[model samples]
Target: MSWFEYRNQVLCAESVSLAHIAKEVGTPLYCYSTAALKANYEEFVDAFRDRDVLIAYSVKANANQAVIATLSACGAGADVVSGGELQRALAVGVPGSRIVFSGVGKTSEEMSAGVAAQVHQFNLESKTQLESLSEIASKQKVEARVAFRVNPDVDAMTHEKIATGRRTDKFGVPIGEARSLYELARSLPGIEVVGVDLHIGSQLTDLEPFKKAFSRLAELVNALREDGHDIRHIDLGGGLGVRYRDEQPPTVSSYAELVDETLGSLGCQLILEPGRALVADAGILLSRVIETKQSSERVFVIIDAAMNDFLRPALYDAWHPIDPVSEPQPDANRDIVDVVGQVCESGDV
Candidate 1:
């Protein structure tokens, strides 16, 4: 509410009232603050001003055209995970050199598109993918600048669904296996090993996991250099959480300090792909209270928005604060009720 505040008893995004938006664009709407997105992007950029850094906005969080264009205009790159996102980044004037194609499963067509685009980096997750990209890059007459999404196996202690860098998870190569893969990549005709990458998890409130993972990455970088790999960049895949509720995640400045301490000595360009930290707070879903039903077990306050519109609540047990556009009266009746969407699923809370 501090950012999207109640001005004169009405919720406003910056200075524009939400009620006016609903009247113009209809309800069950998604609203975002350009100012918030710009500020968040700038804050992260300012933190790493002392070093060579690329702040690639993770498009998975919010693929809204305006959001992508806003960041792109500000000289921010993109970290896209799919072909559609890659095209979106391009349509918004993001050069392929500024986009990093990530994700565990990328189709051959996607790899070909990435090759055609000559993206900044491909975060390869498996041997099969390595061969696939090599074939495509060679056929397309392009050297794919790539990085091994190294699994440090450090538990980020966040939600299991979003955690990527673990021994058990089907993500990046294990730290033990990365060096050999780098050698294999060296032998490949069209694969250029340019960087190391790792993403432990999302919604991380602790910095210890980052310190552990980055420390391991630094060690791996030294080993890679000793082995004559021209490692020029490090993609410390971003999962710095935002305060959807009361979680106190690390600030950009503190995280920058850890980056400087760990990878600064390696002299590699730094890349970060922040998702929720950039977009979650900058936008909100606006819905209407449809009806209220009372049962012996519970009171259900049904809303017009469904699980399909915003799935994080049911999908991740995520909590996003819902507030009335108009402030409640001091004497308004206080009731304990289950606020829910109109989805048919029982877990659509």
Candidate 2:
């Protein structure tokens, strides 16, 4: 199913050769497979076909217009965090009703823009944000459909920087305090409590964390219904991990089954925001090897690409597979060298 494969001893993005692309567009460029993008988006659609689900592609992962438009053509909505992201989604003809504005620090201006666009839901992280949106929407004379992103406090068992559901993280309000906030939201003007939202962390490979969070959310939904709130949506923010190396992420079908098992009885529209899972494997960073040098201790392979160009390795110590554009012979001698960027920083590896 990989679109990037070797054909006739040349690595290709779909049917186009990478060498041809590099020769034409030059190195240090990004190439995305339109077919791969469509296939990834369709996987979600096929998984949740039987349910009332919205697979909102998280725009922050890969905001390329071509990627967004490809997904949009596949009937994918957008999950945007900032005003610029909202505009980007809108620019691709993604309707306001299909956009979910989600972020921890949404400014007043950003909230106003989201309100003006009439985004489907605003995943409010704090009570002050709830109040701000209420005031803005009240002045604008429109009911802003809102969801409270409650912190489930479950460890996603991923990278610490990406793990967000822990109580100490600054993302969502505590779960115990969500009901009281929902009550406050109902009392406030121009705020319509439509759903509940929670995003535990990114690059999550296991389902236990999700099961724990969704179970708690289900309990809250039952409690919220008892308290006389018309909750119609459940925004389970994205954190599904994709395989960068040896990661066996749960299948989309399995994820959908988990959702059904946890919240199917609630009869609410399910919203999933998946960013990296959709585009991570759909694109590749094509760079040329500038030089190879030997040091007293080790050898290094330098490339024209820098840490600023591709930051995962520099930022998260992330690993990505490196391959030569030309297919090497099976018996070709391999040199163990540290592949690094040309950035002036030591962390450029």
Candidate 3:
């Protein structure tokens, strides 16, 4: 069933009405539909039902325990960047072996937590990070499974701030340097070289970047095998986008086909870390108008919400279709009003 719809001249979430939620839970509330989240998650997993894949929900998109726990219930793992996220995953019953830790700057304490939890693999971002993780894991007397995240030097063609695979971005190692890193990891006492990882960027609508990055990764995988490293898993870091407004992102099934066609011959497990694609549409921010004012050149509708309640609009100038909780009458007055938050910032709209 559609999680959000209109019934009896009112907006509803699942079986409950948004107006009812406003009266009880109050406005300026964030609501998520369990059915919607589970359906999207299951759809992604079903797309890879034929492959050895682990769909790890990216927690950075929405870290609510209920959200994580819902995905966890659907057998979803977690792709976390911080120790707190690891803890959150664990708390929600996402085991350590199912978690993949990825980030550019990982504190020693954070590394220790991961080493303690024994996460699935650490997506090695830099040599310095690898060195620190190796030392920490050796002290803990455990072999840390690692996948060297490589920059394929492909443009994701998404927002510049979100694009990660470019050469100038502070992300994974250059594609040309993966072999040397694999050799170096073999020499380390605490690291086990297991797989190759590459994520172009987030909110990517084009499949070309994924194809290019995966093709490069396929070539590198064969090279690594020739170098005698047991490349078991190919962590195709996830950036499959979601429909925030009117985006036409590639389907998860199509992405799976691309992976199978490009690198499936390597006989390696595939891992995807989807964040926004899974959760963004599953949730909604509820607010109410406080007042309506008109100036000489403009009209404004002040809402009870603040920019902090929903930062995407201010952060990325994002667009989300807004509608009245109660359907506006056909004969209702109409005006072009700039709906804004209560913040003092000029951009808090």
Candidate 4:
């Protein structure tokens, strides 16, 4: 079921009458629906049901333990970036093998900790990083399963800050250089190139970009295969968009269909790293009208929640629809509110 249906409102995060959650849990409280989370998770899983897939919930989006525990209960592994996220995933019963670590700068200490944890793979970004991981793995006496995060050089057509796979982005290895990077990994004694990873961007609304990214990656995969590399998985790093507004992005089923049509015959395991779509709508930031004031230019509905509570708006100048639970509703009274939080910063979301 859609999160809208589950929440019984246009919003999916399930704010319990606004007043109730604000009064009980306190204003600025974050509320998530277990049902919405599970349903969204299941939808993604079901999309790739016909293929060998492992959906790893990205921990950076919302690292709440209660939410992670719920996803863990539904057989969701974790895709973590930092050491703290790895610890959080482990704390919530997600096993080591189920976790995949990805980041640009991984410290030796952090690498040592993840190596000790024995995660499934580290989505290595740069050659220097790969070497560092190699040295660390050698010291620890372990074979590190590493995947080259490839920059497909495709435009995800999303915001600049969130875009990762573009040619100019400091995200992954350039698509043309994957073979050389793979050779480098092969030559490294402590590291094994087990898979390929690509993350174009976040808040992507169309499938064409993904298809293009995957198509480019497929050629590289086949090239590696012909070169006698035992590539086991294709980690199509997730950027599945969610409805923060009325528009619809591709459904999980459609994405799965695209994957099936594109690379179903490759026999490599499919791994998805979805963070926002699965949890963003499943969770809602609850705040109250702490005070209302009118200035000469405009009116303000000041609330306790701030950019700190949910940083998306402040970070991206993103839009989130707000409503009042109390009655005396009027269409004329509503307008674009510079709804702000308690942060002392002048630019608060």
Candidate 5:
């Protein structure tokens, strides 16, 4: 259900006025809707209720402790990329057994920390990392549950920085060599090979890439099972995009339908690592209009929020819907204002 509604011609978040939040928390503050977050989580859970799925909330989306704690209280797991995220997840009562770690360059300290925390699984990206993890596990005398992230080499049809599963990207092991890697992990002394994982890319809007990736992953899973390796989990790492601009994204129900159909009757457990889809629309950064500067060709609305506060716009040239809380009448006058932030760099928000 839609939470925000115009009250007296001003948009509010869950009966809490956005203007009030901006004033209370101060400008450049991030306001999150606990209801929205909970609703998004419940939406996905309900859609995939029949499947053996674990919704690992990706912590990188918005790592606020309150947000993490809220999701944890709702029986959601975490998909962490670094030791910091792992610690944050555990700090908020998200059990280590429910955490899946994914990143390309994991340091020795990070591995030791994750091993200490007893994370559920590690989405291994490279052969070198697999060996390192095995060594760390051997030294710690703990069995490391691992899933080799296979790069299906499918184009996710997203921006370059976010596209991960493409052949030119360095995110995962090539699909052709995934089985061999699984065998190698099985033969390793300290590693316990559990499953296969993949993250094609972020902000993915279409289903062809997902379908192709899942089919390829299913083939490898079957082959591995036939060849005497025990693969039990399939992590289709979340890259489902949202309607940040004017584009429309598949609702959580439709997205789950695609996934459910793709892995029909597969014996392995399904794990979805959703981050942006759950939190993006639930939270928004509010900044006060610091000043209005006029230019020869345009006008700029300099706000207090900077790259430090919300970097998506600057980092990815991402589009975030902006609206003035107390705006003048629409028919009064119109001017194209470039809403910007206070960072001291060209790439700053």
Candidate 6:
């Protein structure tokens, strides 16, 4: 189910040989498959066709202009966390009405820019930030549609660095304190409480955590409705995992079913922010082997790509399969050598 495959005796990305691309573009380059990107976006659209949903591709995943534009052409909106990202999405022809501004730290200038652009919604994280947005929106004489990203305290069971829904995580307002904050937002000027947002974490493989978090979200939405707030949309920030190693991530159809089972009765628009799931497999960092070093006890295959070029392995000990552009014979000899980068650091492997 991947666009990158080995054809004959060479590796290819949707029929274009990786070896040819490296020969032309040089080493340490990123190659993305346009076909794969469109396919991934279309899969999400097809899965949610029956429901009122907005698939906002998270810009932070892969901010390449070509990647964003390709998704935009496939009817994908954007979930941006900064003013620059918002501009990128807009420059790529994503309408302001289709962009959701989200971040914990929003400067006055960023808020002003978002307000001026008439963004679809602002996923506010803190009361002070919410107050700042209200003041800015009031000054601009426009009501800013807002949603409180609530921390459901449900563990996403993902990596510690990526988890954002836990009680200790500094991503969103605590769920217990959300109702009171909603009450305050109701009284604030130039603010419209249109929805609730929940983002647990990134690279989530299982559905139990999502189910628990979404069930909590459902309760909060009902309570907010009883409090006279028109909860029109639910922004379930994306954290769906993909096959990175042995991880068998849930299918998009199954994820859609989970959403329907949890919040289908609410009759609100659903917003999903999927970043890694859509683009991770569609692109590859094509690096050439610089040299091979043999020590007394071990061997190292140094690559032209460094940690600065691809930091996930160094940052999170993430694993990515490496293969030569020229296919080795089925009975070729194998070596237990460490694949390293020329970063001149001990942790460069």
Question: Where does candidate 6 have its weakest 10-residue lDDT segment?
Answer: 340-349
**C-alpha lDDT of residue 98 in model 1:** 93
Query: What's the TM-score of every candidate structure?
Result: 0.98, 0.99, 0.98, 0.93, 0.95, 0.98
* Root-mean-square deviation per candidate: 1.1, 0.8, 1.1, 2.5, 1.6, 0.9
lDDT against the true structure, each candidate: 0.91, 0.94, 0.90, 0.85, 0.86, 0.94
Tens-digit per-residue lDDT, 54-163, candidate 6: 89999999999999999999989999999899999999899988999999888999999999999999999999988999999999999999999999999999999999
How many clashing pairs does model 5 include? Answer: 0
Please identify model 6 stretches exceeding 4 Å from their true place. none
The better candidate by TM-score, 5 or 6, is 6
Q: On residues 1-349, what C-alpha lDDT tens digit does candidate 5 reach at each position?
A: 6566667777788888888887677777777889999999998899899888889999998789899999989989999999898889999999988899999888878988888889888999888988999999999998999999999999999988899998899888999988888878888877999898999998888878888998888888888889888888999999898887777766778887877777766777888999988898887777788899998987888888888877777878888767767655768777778887887886774
| Backbone-clash count (model 4) | 0
lDDT of 1 by residue, 241-303 (tens): 888778888998999999998778888899999988888788889988999999999999999
Clashes within 3 Å, all models in order: 0, 0, 0, 0, 0, 0
Clashing residue pairs in candidate 5, if any?
none
Error of 4 at 77 (Å): 0.8
Global Cα lDDT for candidate 1: 0.91
Question: Of 3 and 4, which scores higher on TM-score?
Answer: 3
Candidate 4: global Cα-lDDT?
0.85
Scored by Cα lDDT, where does model 2 land? 0.94
Deviation in angstroms for 172 in model 4?
0.6
